[model samples]
Structure formats: structure tokens, C-alpha cells
Target: MGEDDDGGREVYGKMRAAAALRQIPRPPPTTFQEDLMEHLPAAIYTLLSCWTRFYQIGKNNHVVWDEAHFGKFGSYYLRREFYFDVHPPLGKMLVGLVGLLSGYNGHFEFKSGDEYKEDVPYVAMRVMLATFGVLMVPLAWYTAKELGFSNRAAHLTTIMVLCDVAWLCISRFILLDSMLLFFTVLTVFCLTRFHTERHDPFSPDWWVWLTFTGISIGCVASVKWVGLFVTALVGVYTLEDLWEKFGDLRMRKRDYINHWLARGLMLIGMPLFIYMMSFKLHFIILNHSGPGDAQMSSLFQANLEGNDFSKNPLEVAYGSKITLKNMGFGGGLLHSHVQTYPVGSQQQQVTCYHYKDDNNNWRVEKPWTLPKVDDAGEIEFLKHGDIVRLQHTPTNRNLHSHNVVAPVSKLNNEVSCYGNATAGDAGDHWQVEIVDDLVFGKREKVPRVRSLTTKLRFRHVLSSCYLVAPNSVLPPWGFKQIEVSCDKQNNPSDPHSHWNVESHWNGRLPVGETKFYKSPFLRDFWHLNVAMMTSNNALVPDADKEDILASSPTDWPWMHLGLRMCGWGDNQTKYYLIGNPAVWWSSTLSLGICVIVIAVYLARMQRGYRDWGVGEWDHFLYVCKIAGLGWFFQYVPFLIMGRVTYIHHYLPTLYFAVLMVGHLFDHFVFKSRRLKDTTKWVIFGIATGIVIGVFWWFRGVAFGIDGPIKEHWGLLWRKSWNIYESH
Candidate 1:
């Protein structure tokens, strides 16, 4: 009986213990709390770093560098200016939207270095850009953490970015670089997150990360085409990830196809949709005409409201007042002004002007006789191969070309408006051969303005040369417009010699059907893309005269130069865009160290020293390789680019390079088994402290503090910094 009672007590005691355990609250796992704690320092540092000098962004009430370009574009959007840029429209659209919301009138000219008057509301734009700039630090910090850097290393990486003077200067201005960098870094961070969670494949959380990464990629590319580099990086990583999955023995073929389909929909389809939507929004918002109309086609211009091209397309006839447009790409309207090429033929200069003006108008006439009007108001229609004379309206001179050489094209015959006499000489006579096409087994002469395919060649009767608008700019004497000359080769197929009547007026004929109705979006999209590409390709800065602020990719990695954003009165109110020297140099050195460490690791592995634990080291090495590849793709491509690049172009590369530095320091220095924790902390502390100190010292340049030149010079350690002083 005693034994049984003891057994019952034991069982009851065990039950009571179990109930007590269940009653006690099981607090949420510390893993999430641990993660928050781990990232706490970096989060705090990023916030303080971004917010510290944020308000000071608007101190300088003036336009700087490309601020003039982008600011004007923003205003143009609000006023519905049909402008063109080499980049995609999302960044400028955002600026425009912000300006509109803030009650900005969009009236400021935003000329280079122009001071904003008291009433001009420029603060909102600057603050908005600065806000994006400040966010870069946190984005970069998150990226580093996701890439497997330790907490201290992640915090230090944020510090390096926050302390960059170039980053600060660019952020504080109304520029696209900040927005571009923000989206680009966000893309990389999201991609890292996606990669980390990719083991789950088609899980809901995994899909969300993948989708976010795709959207971020679209946003980055929408800012600048340079975002393609990030796109390539993500693309390669994804392909490699999928390839590894396919090779996995346990993975079924069906799962592989599903993975591929999922990635295709998210990465390819989603990004394309978002990118097209950006352009759609751009086309919708900018409904009115602006300065950029001249760069587009007649059909495109006809679509804009309040544009001269939007007028009725008139019929062609003798004595018609018309504007002759070049049919070639980037061709302009035939124009003549009172000014002549000072050195060339001393007659009135005949050139091609991209915009419409009184000088562009000309009266069509027979070779020597005036067209007779019938009693019923009927007039002679200008036919193919008809010899005619073009009389300049403003100058009352005939379109003439002789053996004289052109100012720009020395080999070509000079074209000018000549002859004070109404009955001009043979030099004024030209055969107008209309471009023809076979229609229903018969060659039909194409009419002017009615058919865009119509091409005309003005063959000089005496000189035996064809009127040609070369893709070259004339001298200042010719108003710096496109050069129009007479080429000896009168190839009817040459587009440069092809002419079409763009603006026509004939009293005898009624106005034709209007071609300005809304067309299909795809057709407009195709045409606009072609026009934008043509315009962008034409924007080649002269290589012989390099701008003082221009930089090359080779110069970027060495921190060899700085750009002058703006200045007033010999360095007064100067804004110099230079990276923080300590940060740049340290990051640059870290890259070299990373290379050496990687080599040594490879050597050790080749010699069969594999005891370092394969899984952890392999993961670390893989992340480093990816970060290195990102840096390479961003920086190396600029080496071959022919465009005029600036120091700000290096900002994207700097983001990845700084991440590599953080990764290197975390793995090799901070986590080194040979080094004591105290020593590691000391090293990191000194490095970060120096970077912060330098950033604070040069904070004047970033914030546009105006004072004595010597005061600013005292803070610079590199002699290249003197470039700003001389400027």
C-alpha cells in the first residue's frame, strides 16, 4: 500500500510540473529579437547620418551643374513641354510631380549657376533629392548585412557612404544621380534578399522578394540606362541559381520548369511592364509642345498641341509659300538669314534650322516665270522633275549654289541666298525631282507634305550639284545652325539630299485631312524611341576641347579628380564634388587586399588545405565574388564609353566597392581568429573616426558654404582639390 501511494505521488508531481511549464508564457523566439539587436547600430547610424545635415541642403539658392538641365525639364513637364533627354523619364517626372505638389510655378529658367530669386520655390526639389540621397546610406547598410557582413562591418559601411562628400554634394542638388543611386542600391539589396530566400523556391514570401527585386530593377533602369548594369548582374546571378537547381539530383524536371517560368514572369515580364508604364505616364503627362519639338519628326510634332506642325497639311502648287524640310534623320527646315559665312561666299547664309521661323519660309516659282491663276482660282501643280526657283521671303534672294566651298564641308559647293535681281541667273535654277513609287503597275509622283515618303532633290542647273544638308554644324557666323551645301554626287537615294515640303500654303487648294489624331500607342512608342535614339547619338561633345569638369573611368578608381558643380565670383559660393579622401582611399585599398586574400585562399585550397570548413567559406567567397562582379560591371564599362562622363558617374561603382570593403573587413579583420577582439575594435574605430572627421571638415564644400578660398583649401589633403580653387 505504501509503495502504490508513493508511485501515485510521483505521477502527480510530474503532471504538476508539466502544467506549470505550460502555464508559463513562452516568449517569442529571440532570433527575431537577435536580428533586430544585431542591426540596431547600423540602423541608428544610418538615420543620424542622413538626418544630420539634411535641412542644410537648400542653403544655396542657385542652380548647379546639370541642375539647370533637370530643373528646366521638371518645369517643362508641368507646363507640358515635349522635351527629350538621353535618360528615361521617371526621375524628372518625380521631380516635376513634387514641384507641382509643392505649388511651384515652374517659371524659373534654371540657367547654369543662376541664383534663385527670393520668390522662387526651389527648396522642395532640393529637399526631395536630398531625401533620396540620405536614404542611400541605409540601403547600402541593409545590402551589406544581407551580403553576410557582420554588424560592425555593416555599420562601418554605412559610415563610409554617409561620409562621402561627392555623395552629399550630388544629393543636395536637383540631379538624377541621387535618384538613380537610390533605386540601384535598393535593387541590389532586394536581390540579395531574394537570393537568401531562394531555397524556398515558390513560397509566397519568396515570390514577394523576387517581385520586389524585379520592380526595383525596373525603377533603376527607368532613371538611367546605366541601370542595365545592375540588371545584368541580377540576370547572371539568377541564371546561375537556376542552373544549380537544375543540376541538383533530387530536383525533378517539373520543378525546374516551374522555377524557370516563375522567374521569367517575375524578372522579365514584370520589369518590361513597369518600364513601358513609365513611358506611358511620361507621354500622357507631357501633352503640350516645348523646346524639344525641333528634335522630333514632323508627324510627332503634328501630335503636339499649339505647334506649327499641327496646322492643316496643304496641297502643293506653284507660288506656294512653303518650308522645305530635309527628309534625312535629324534634318531641319531649309533656312536662310542675312548673316553669311565671313570667310566663305559673302552671300546670305543658307542653313537648316530645327525650329520654325520667318527665315524658314520660301516662295515656289517656275525657273523664270510666275504661275498664272485661272478665272476659277486654279493654279499649276508643281510636278516631278520640274525646274523651279526658291525665293527666300525675308531676304528676297534666290537659293543659289556655286563652285565656292562651304564653311563646314570644305569639299562641298557653297549654298547661299544670292541675286538681288528678281530674275535670278542660272545658279538659282534647280530641277525638283519628286521621289516616286510604283502604284498599280504605274509610277506615281509623291505629293509634298501629303506623303512623308516623298523625297525631293534640288539639282543646281549650272553647278550640277544636289542640295545637301550635312550632319555638321556651321560656324557662329551662320548662327551655329546645320550646314546646307551642294554635293557633287546627286544620288537620288541619298537621304541627306532629300527634301520634303513640311509647311505649305496654297490659295487655290483647300486644306487636306488633319493627320494629328491619336495613333496607336505601339506605333508612337516605336517612332519616339527611334527619334530619342537618333537625338542621343547626335549629342557628341567635341573631344578636342575637354570640359574642365569631365572625368574618365580610369581616373575614377584612383580618386584622381573632382568636378566643379558651381561657383560665384572666383570660388565664392563654390560647390565642389569630391569624394571624402579617407573613405575613397580606404575603400580602394580594401579592394586590393580582397584580391590578395582571394588569391591566397585559392592557393591554400589547391594545396589541399580544406580544413577551413567548406560550407561557410564557400558561401562567403560566393558573396564576395558577386559583390566584386557588381563593382566590375558598373565601373569597367565606362572605360569604353565615348560619351562625356563626370565624377558622379562613379557613384554607382562606389556603392558596390564600399560593400566589398565592409565584407573584407568583417571576414578577415574583425572575425580573424588570430586577432583579439579589442584590437579589431581599435582598428575599426580609428578608420571610421578618420572618415567622419574628414567628412565634417569638408562639409563646407558639400553644403555650399561661402567664405575665403584659403579656409576651404586648409581642409583638403590632395593637391587635385586645388582644381576647384583655380576654377
Candidate 2:
């Protein structure tokens, strides 16, 4: 009887195993055609079709010099811009696809020398952006489905996101903002699905959730480190998801906690890892260098290795080039060039480097600097005003009077220091040495730090020099900003250092609890720990320098209206500036409007949050805190920027303002607590009004102002593109 019973049980177990195996067999693979099943994909394709055509619009125009990304596509197969410029490559990748489909005629491959054709590239890019913009509708629909939202509401959210001008403008640009949005949306969708499937521990749902998270974050990080901000924002949502599961569930506390821990590991942690991994791999796939200086790669590697990088996270992980640890001593390579501007000088006198072999020994040769020697005739400590003359450079004698900022080399182009075999021009040769620079401090009782400048310059145009400061002031510099200038031309010895004719001016801007200085959301926000104002580093081209400088007074031609231009399409160069006044006004308005709207939202929610579950408090806190964080990361940066001259390295800060404002708009307009109709209209009016009003301020009103504005509206357009003179 026992043997018979054992046989029966074994047979039953086999039958169960077979049934489970049958149920979980591998599914069939999805075909490429399967992805384009219906109206949704078709709409996406149509939208994309327009931008692919428009991005290369100026291919045949021959009007402008064609400095855009699409115009340079044909220069290389992958068609990326210059090596060191930091721009996300996803948009360019799409442009490449368009170029391929268009028989190398779209934005990526369109261009004839320095000019472009008609509306082709622009139109193409716009359509592509529109498609991506519209596609958000369906993706949001999917998110709603996963989040248990009704089809109707999901569809509504899609429509709202699509119609937003913020979305529209971002999509239209050859930038990564839209792509970042796309990734963000994808992450939400995946996370929603994961939330629904958490109960099934042994199911394939976890893997599905993991894969989506990885893809979404990889795309997000590829576009910008700003994606990290999104990651942090979503963390609140994750905690909420975990908290909800922990309460009123069948599982014990430990089991529930484990579920959340697993989810965090799979979703957030894995996503971050995959996001960083793509930075290393994507460039190889696209055949382009990854985002500027292989930063994304090194940052992740350093974190994992935990090898000395964390000691100064500021240097290793700043968005721009900070000295990399792996880059090695004095940030590696060295003794490149020397460019110094005695406190009173903007244009510099350079002293370059050379190498000589005496008999069998080699020595690094500098310009034989004549520092202030002691009475014993030995070179000693520097003080007061002392000049070091150059041994090789001619005194820029033949420079034309009309040439306001001509290159010194142009005055002696006849000299063949370049392209000749004698000066090591045919190989990777460099001048090697180091120089120390002294800087003023701003922090209380903070002593000045030594700045070691060592680098390798192009074709061996190396130089060497030292600097001395009164050593007064505090927090001397960001250490990186220790150079003499932020402007490129003023940097006679090295191109990397920045210069600002005005940043070093004595005294600080007045600071207090003004609207601009106050934190929009949070109280007790950190004061400016350090500040470094910079000038645009873009060089004055040989052909345009004279024309640019001629627009303003000789004293500060850099402020000339003629050079203050940045526009595209219909606006062109009317009164252009890289920074649109309309945009700034809109951004500022967006902040004020956002606060007003969110405040009204929370006030209404407080009236009835008690009726809902604890989840309401979590959501409320997120909204409240982020509103403050938005100001910290965005509004505050801009307000601080306004206190000083605008600089180039601060360009990324504008993006922060734009994105935060967009989020603030999105939160109140689309996702605010289900509120009254009167509240919705009120919020909409304020936010929309502010944006429009600000836009108008930049476009129509800035040039009309008199006083300093009237004297040189032409010179200040780097702040806006279209000023009156070159006024």
C-alpha cells in the first residue's frame, strides 16, 4: 500500500511540472512590422517625416555660413560636430536616419560648403519633433493603463502634453530635452507596470519591468545628466509605492520590505547602471565620441571603484571639463601655453616654450622670464608691476587698425612655426612645464590656493608664465576659474582658461531677501557658496571680428549689438542674442505663475486631503517640495546670474530654468490634484500669461529702453540676439 501511494504522488508531481512548463513557454518574437500595427505608429511616422526633411533646409540657400549640426553631417559618416563640444547625440542620430532615408539629402547630409538651401531641414526637423511630441499621447495612454487610469483620462493627458508649447518648442530643436522627456515618460510607464505586478514574485513581470527601466534610463542619461534630476524626483514616487504595499497587505513586514528592496534594485539601481553603460557603448555604435570628455563613463567608473574620486566630487563630476582623476597629475600632459593679462590688460603678450638638446642632454626651455630678482641678482619672489618680454613672438605690428581682435599669428602668417618639420609640427609634440597663479578669495578667512597650469597646446605652441595676486579676498576661486580670462582671445597662451574683463572687478553685488534672492519654495536655501562669472569663450572669427567690434565703442566693443545675435528661421538676425529676452521673461513668469497655481492647488487639496488615504500626503509633499527644489535648481540660478555679466559656461543653467518651469507648468496644468474648474482656469491664466508676457518683453521691449540700453543696445545682445547698433 505504501509503494502504491508513493508512485501515485510522484506521478501527480510530474503532471504539475508539465502543466507549469507549458504555461510559461517562450513567447514568439515581435517583428519590425508588428511595431507599426495601427494609426498610432502611422501618426508618429508622419510627424517624424516632417522634421527629417526640415533639419537640412538650408543645404542649398548659400545665405548663412551654415554652423548648425545638420549642415555639418556630411563632413563625417556619423556626422557629429567638433570633438570637444558637449551636445547629446540622439537628435543627430535621428537626423542621420533621415539623411539615409533621403538619399543623403536630409539635414544630416545637406550643405554645400558654408551655405544651406531653403526650408527643407527646418521643416524636416519640425515634423520629426511634432511626431515625437504627438507620440507622447499614446505613451501616456499606456502609462495611464498601467496606472489604472481610465482610457478617457489617459487620452486627455496625452492631448494636453502634445498641445503644450513647451513640448512643441523643445521637440522642434535638435537638442536632447524632448528625448529626455521621452525617457522620463517611458520610466513612468515601466514603473506603473512594476507596481501592478509586484505580487507575483516568481513571474516574468519583474524581468519585463527591469528591461523597460533599463531602456528608459539609458535613453534619459544619454540625453543629459539632468536625467539624474528626474531620477531623484521619481524617488518619492518609489517610496510611496513601497509604503502603500507595506500596509494592509497579506505579507509580513519583512516580506513586504524585501519586495520593495528588490524593486529598488531592479528598477532604480539597474536603470542608473544601464543609463551610464550606454554612454560608453552608444558612441561606439554611433561612431562618435561620447558626451564631452568621456565624462559619463569616468563618473560611473569612479563611483564603482571608489578610488579617491569621492574626495572632491565637484571636480570629477561637474557637467563640464573638470580635471579627471585618471587624467593624472596636474590633470595630465602639460607645459602647453602661457597667457597672462596684467590686472589692467585684456589683450596679452605671450611667452611660448621650446625644447633644446645640448650635447646629449635634453632640457625644457621657457621664455626666460625675468622675475623681480633680489639685490644679489638672483630671480626671487614677485611683487608690484614687472613685465616679461617674449623671445619668439613679433609685436603684432602689421595688424590693421580696423581689426579689433585679430589673431596675433595673422600679423605674421609668413612665419612658418606651424606646418613645418623643424618645430615638430609633423608629430604629436608639446611644450612641457608648469606655472603657478595666485587668485583673490571671497570666503571669510579663506586663504588663497595655488593653481598649477600645465597643458599641451596645438602644434607645440606651448608657453610658460606665473601670476601674483594681493591674496586678499576669500574663497579665491572655484580653483578652475583661477585663469586670467574667460574670453578665448584674451587667452594668448591657452584656450581652456576663461577670462571676464568685469568679473574680477572689486566688490560683490548687493544681496538680501529680495524676490530675486529669496528661494521660491524653500526657506533657508544655501547662499552662493562660490561664484565665478565668465565671458563667452567663442572666438572672434577673422572674417567677422572687425565687423563685430565696429558695432560698439572701442572701450567695450564686446558689448556691441552687432555681435549680440542668436536666432533661427523667421527671426534670423534682426536683433538677435543667444539668450532670448522673451524666453527669460517667460521663464521668470513661469516661476511666479507656477507658485501661484501650485499654491492654489495645495490650498484646495488641504480642504479635503483628509478624505483620501495617506497617499495624499506623500503626493502633496512631493508637489510642495519639488516646487521649492525647482526654484533652487532653476530660478535661483538665473536670479544669481542676473547679478553679474552673463557667461558661456553658465549656458547649461538656462536649460535648468527651462525644464523646471516646464515641470511646474506640467504639474499644475495637467497633473495637479483633481480640483475645481475655477481653480484650473485660474492656474492656467497665470502660468500662460507670465510666459507670454515675458516672451514679449524680450522680443519687443528690450531695445526700446533708453540710457545705457540706448547707447549700446548693439553690444549687449549676447544676452539677447537682436540689439540695434552692433548699439
In model 2, what is the error at residue 712, expressed in angstroms? 26
Question: In model 1, what is the error at residue 400, expressed in angstroms?
Answer: 7.2
Tens-place lDDT digits, model 1, residues 1-727? 7655775566756754553343313224469878788668657766775675474767777787898999898898888878877678899998898778767788889998888877667887777777788788778777877777776788788898888888888888788988998998899989988876755678887999999998998899888888879888888888987876655545689999998998899888888888788888887887787877655555556677776544444556777888887766667789999886787779898988877689999988677655432425657777777788899988889999889998888889999998853556778889887665222121263544242334567888888899998667764456557889999986877877988676777656676644533445665565456555544555545645667778777777778888777774644577778888887787778778888888898899899887464245656766776778888888888887756688888998888888888888888788688999899999899979998998888887787767666654565566665443655
RMSD (Å) per prediction:
10.7, 19.1
TM-score between model 2 and native: 0.44
Q: Tens digits of per-residue lDDT for model 2 on 390-433?
A: 11222211100111221332221111111111122211122222
Candidate 2: regions farther than 4 A off: 1-82, 87-102, 105-114, 117-130, 140-157, 192-207, 243-261, 282-326, 329-339, 343-727
Off by over 4 Å in 1: 1-32, 324-353, 357-362, 367-378, 384-500, 506-516, 538-546, 570-572, 723-726
Clashes of each: 0, 61
RMSD of 1: 10.7
